[model samples]
Target: MAYQCDLGNNQTVYLDNSGSQTIVTTASGSPGQQQQSSNSFETGAWTAPPEMYRTPGGVTLKIQAQGGDRWIQIQGQSSNLSDASSIPLQEVSQVPGSSQQPMQPMQPMQPMQPMQPMQPMQPMQPMKMGNMEMNNNPMEMRMGNMEMRMGSSPQNTGSQRRFCSQCGSPVQPSDRFCGNCGHKLS
Candidate 1:
């Protein structure tokens, strides 16, 4: 069966109900001048085109029903619509096997508090030294009261040679006297 309605400005809407699907079509002015659009909605798990109808003012209205998911959506399009006009009159989504609750309008949010000022940082004092000596080789560092040094362990040059303390002369390891000054090297 089909139902028909006149929409003032020479426009007519036709709704055809047959089988498990319903189709809605609109025609305006003369048959040849009609900017015709049609949509169909079905009752089963099968997919169908969304239902759309346009007013005489060129504003299009669309509706979609998902029979398997149990959700319905409605939207409108207009040339005068603003970019920020996004809040739908009604919206719904369903999660399979979960309970669903109706939606409520959101409340106005409270303003945030101002941030606190930061405290100034204290300056650090430089380290004091009585007498400090620094060397590049092995990097030796000495403070007046303390010493910090880094180097490898002392190594043996060769046979243990000795020096005569009285005349400052080189002495062999087994020498009993300085060979040049004859100083007794006990």
Candidate 2:
């Protein structure tokens, strides 16, 4: 004792009361005349299932046996009921305007360079004579505290000048060009 037969707008016709009596017939277009029939008195002008049924892209439908499930919503392209279990193998080739997605190309970028400038140098000459100033004999008055060494000392190797054997005169004390001219150049 269960009931539901709303072949109404969206359509839903499913019946199977435990055992016995079964009928299912649908018609929209000629569909090659007919595909299935079980006219048990052929009820109604037969024109429900459209309150919101649809097909063509988005589809929805259901029908189970043993008095249970039932539903159908179609908008176009009706195939009664039984697409051999809904066809979907990528809809089997149908290309009109071409569109499955895939395309890419774009690249252009290069420009950057600038830097050069360096040249200026000429100035050098200094070994000795930045106003020469140095004259402190006695090695600094004997360095570590005097010990008597009266000038005329440093001749370790230069300018002890005792000249004038005859006239080179540099004889230390007193005139005698004869020392320089004194004809004594020792």
Scored by TM-score, the top model is 1
Report the alpha-carbon TM-score of model 2 versus the true structure.
0.15
Cα lDDT tens digits, model 2, 28-138, are: 324355332222321222222211233444344443434444444422445544332342211113122223444556667667666666664443332223433222343
> Candidate 1, residue 111: CA error in Å?
76
Alpha-carbon lDDT of model 2: 0.34
Q: How well does each candidate superpose onto the true structure, as a TM-score?
A: 0.25, 0.15
Which tens-of-lDDT digit does each residue in 1-186 have in candidate 1? 344545557865554434565555666666557566666666443244333334333433333334442222222334433332322221123222223444677999999899888886553433435576665455556554344556754344554346787986778767898999999998
User: Least accurate stretch of 10 residues (summed lDDT) in model 2?
Assistant: 87-96
Which runs of model 1 end up more than 4 angstroms from their true locations? 30-32, 44-186
